[model samples]
Each structure stands twice: as structure tokens, then as C-alpha cells.
Target chain A: MKFGVIVFPGSNCDHDAYHVISKHVGQPVEFIWHKETDLSGYDAVIVPGGFSYGDYLRCGALAKFSPVMAAVKEFAAQGKFVFGICNGFQILCEAGLLPGALIRNKNLHFICKHVNLKVENSNTPYTSEIAEGEVLSIPIAHAEGNYVCDDETFHQLEENGQIVFRYCDENGEVTDEANPNGARSNIAGICNQDRNVLGMMPHPERACEVLLGSDDGRNIFRSLTKAIAAHG
Target chain B: MKAKVYVTLKPSVLDPQGKAIHHSVELLGFEKIADIRQGKYFEIALDATLSDAEARETAEKIAKDVLANPVIEDYRVEISN
Candidate 1:
């Protein structure tokens, strides 16, 4: 499936996401500028990580107003796939594609490290290839990854099975120590109600190669390919 | 006209940056402080032709829609000529 990577002015990981899709995933991908308002040609759209608009006002706050975001909202409404990583996840949250907001890290420091994430709902399109309760090591780099939401919304997310991944220990145990950024209930990733959109704090693109530390993230792409092929 | 906006996190949500600053303040020997919460301030310029009520309304709308995420923040708008 063809993928389009959304590139805002300060997006640095757009190239990384493009490289992973083309070189590793062997899929055709293109960079779509934030100002462009079209996304009809792509089967999937990826919002890659970076400090869009220099993180002014708040992270991803300024980025939600970019013209492309309107197109993205339309694309997702049509049930098209949308994947967001790290800052991309923040953008999606700010754009209201997903519930909850990422706040400052509990320690008030920028954290960069590899953390284990347990696949919470493997039946979804993004995690179909991953087994439930399986842990994948992925690196996360950010200062505002602390996810928060009101009690009612949190219950809705839980009851609807919208949560896709959660921080866990090596043994696949969900614990406070494994929560690198103090995300609520150790959440690392989540999908929209329709399951067509996903936003995660971990950088799966950066973990697609064994040479770079882990290749476990490749399963996410493989899962998408399988799902699209089987249903499309 | 100038619009001054103040955005702050909701009381229920945690504010790690503000908490860190509070701890630092305590380290500096300041005690008896109840709590601390951090927020953002913005100054927006509007056309002079707009009336006071119109400017306040515009400022409130922007402050609600753009300057803050209502889900997690509370914003106050003050207009000055």
C-alpha cells in the first residue's frame, strides 16, 4: 500500500519514516507538506515525529491548524489508516483525532530510552501481527509524553478497547517503573474508535532495524500490510 | 486593541513542570506555599475598529479554540484598548 508522510516545517523524522517505509517495509511512500490540503492518493498517511512550529505555545498545539490536518481528518473519516509516532502522536491528540493529551514528563526532563511495550489489543489493524501480552522494545524520545484524560473519557477508552499498547516490563508485566513518561495506566499507544487511526509515543520507525537496537517494530508495518491485503 | 490571554492546566490534571518548580522554590528556602501551577500567556493584537464587546468576544473565542485546549486547560481573556 502506498503511504504518505506528513511533513510540517520543523518535522525531522519525516525522512526517517519515509526511509523505513521505502527501504525496510518495501512500500511506496511520499512526503506530503503540511500546507498541502490533499491526501486522496494515499492508502495510509503517517504523521512523523518532530517539534512542529518549534513546539511554540505547546507541543503540537500550533501544528493542528496546518492545512493538511483538515485533509487528514477527512482521510481518517473515510476509514483510511493514519499512524502517528511520538510528536506525531501529540499532533494527532491536539488535532482531536484521538482522546487525551500528553503533558510534561513527571520528572520534568526529556527522556530518551528504550522501553518495553505490551501489545494490549492485538486484534486491531496496527497490532494484528503482535500477540496479546507480548512485549516489544521500542525507543521513545520526548519531554511531554505523559498522557492524561478525564475520568469519563478514560473509562470510555477502556470500555471500547481503544487502548492498543501499554508500558510494561521485560516480563510483559504492566508496572509503574516501566512507565517512562508516567502515561496514565502505563499507556504507550491508542487507536480511535473506528480503529483506523493510531497514535503512539514510542518511535517504531527508529526501531525497525536490528542494527539500530530492535526490529520488533517491523511487526506493526507487517500487520498493516496483512490487514490491507486481506480486507482490500 | 490588545487581547491578553492566560491559559492554565485544569485543576484535575497533573502539572509536572509546575511541580518541579515548586520543589525548586522549596529548595531555595521558601516554605508555607500551598501549591503551584504553571500556565501560558499570550498577547494578541486586534484592529482598532472593533468595539470593546466585539474584541472581548473575539479574544474569548480564540482563547477557547486556539490559545488553549479546553479539555485540559482553562483560559481567561482580557482586552485593553
Candidate 2:
């Protein structure tokens, strides 16, 4: 499947995502600039992490109004896959593709570290290869990854099985200490109601190589490939 | 005309920066303060031809739709002569 990685100005991880898709996942991928509004040719879109728009007025706030976001919204509405990581996650939420807003880290600091994430739901396209309740080590870097939404929306996400991943310890135990940013319910990732769109704080692309740290993130890409094949 | 917008986190939402500031203030011996909540302020200059009411309306709309995120924050707009 052909993948498109959206690149907004100040996006540092765009190349990393591109490398993971083309080199690691062995898929054809291209960079789609934020000014370009067309996404019809791509089967899937990956919004990589970075300080888009210099994180002005709040992270991902200004980037939401970029021309490409409108096209990205349309792409996802067609039931195509859209994966957003870190700042990309913030952008998705700002674009209303996903629920909740990412606020300042609870500690008021930019946290950069490898954290364990437990798969809460493995049935979606993004997490299909991951076993339920399995823990994967993923690196997260952000100062505003604290996810928050109203009680009603939070409940809706839970009831819909949209909460795909949660912060957890190495032993797969969810606890306060495991929550790196104090995200609501220790949520590390979630998908939309249709499960076609996913937004997560952890950077899976950063963990795709064993030499860098862990190759646990390759499972997500593998899952996506499998899901796309089945989708056809 | 000039318009000022104040955007603040909703009461139910947590404000980590504000919390840190509150703790610092307490440490500085200002123990009587009840709480602290950080927010953003924006001053916008509108077209000079617009009337005060028109500027106020425009500012209000901008505050609601653009300057503030309704999901986690509230905003108010004030127009000045």
C-alpha cells in the first residue's frame, strides 16, 4: 500500500516516518507538504511528530488550519487509515478527527523517554498485530501530551472500544507511575469510532529499528499492511 | 478599534503550569492564595472603519471559533475605543 506522510513546517520526524514506511515496512511512501491539499492518491496517511507551526498558541493549534488538514479529513472520512503520532496526535485532535485535547504535561516539563504501552484493543487496523494486554516499549517526546476530554466523550470512547493503548509498566500493569504525561485514564492512544483514524502520543516510527532501541513498533506497521490488504 | 481576547482553561481541566506557579507562590510566603490558573491573552487591532458594536461582535466570534478551543477552554472578548 502506498503511504503519504504529511509534512508541516517544523516537522522533524517526517523523514523518520518516511524511513520506517519505505525502508522498514517496505512500502512506497511520499511526503505531502502541508500546503498541498490533495491526498486522493494515497492509501494511508501518517502525520508524524514535530513542533508544527512552532507550537504557537498551543501545540497543533495553528497547524490545524493548514490546507492539507482539510484533505486529510476527507481522506479519513473515506474509511482510509490515518495514523498520528505525538504532535501529529495533537493535530488530529485539533482537527476534530479525534476527541479530546492534549494539554501541558502534568509535570510542566517536556518528557522524552521510552515508555511502556499496553495494548487495550488489538482489533483495529493500527493494533491488529499486537496482542491484547501486551506491553510494547515506545518512545514519547512532548511537553503537551496530557489528553483530556469531557466525561461524556471519555465514556463514549470507552464504550466504543476506541481506547487502543494505555500507559503501563513493564509487567503490563497500568499505574500512575507509568503515565508519563498524566494523560486522562493513562491513555496513550485511541482511534475514532470507525477505527479508521488513530492518534497516539508515543512515536512508533522511532522504535522501528532494533539498533535504535526496540523493534516493537514494527508490529504496528505490519498490522497496518495486513489490514490494508484485507481492506482491498 | 482594538479587541482583547482572554482564553482560559475550563474549571474542570487541569492546568499544570498554573499549578506550578501556585506552588512557587506558596513557597515565596504568599500562603493565603487559594489557587492559580494560567491563561492566554490576545490583543487584536480591527479595521478602523468598523463601529464599536461591529468590532465587538467580530471579536466575540473570533474568540469563540478561532482564538479559543471550546473543548478545553473558554474565551471572552473585549473591544476598546
Per-candidate TM-scores read: 0.98, 0.98
**Which lDDT value does model 1 have at A194?**
94
Report how closely model 2 matches the true complex, as a DockQ value. Answer: 0.87
Could you say which candidate leads in lDDT? Answer: 2
CA-only RMSD, every prediction: 1.0, 0.9
Query: What 10-residue stretch in candidate 2 chain A is worst by lDDT?
Result: A223-232
Q: List model 1 lDDT by residue over A1-232, tens digit each.
A: 7899999989989998999889988988999999999898788999999999999988899999999999999999999999999999999999999999999998878999999999999989899998999999999999999999998989999999999999999999999988888889998999999998999999999999999999999999889878767756
Q: What is the interface RMSD of candidate 2, in Å?
A: 0.6
Residue pair clashes in candidate 2: none
Worst 10 residues of 1 chain B by lDDT: B63-72
Tell me the fnat of candidate 2.
0.79
Per-model chain B TM-scores are 0.95, 0.93
**TM-score (second chain) of model 2:** 0.93
* lDDT (C-alpha, whole model) for all candidates: 0.92, 0.93
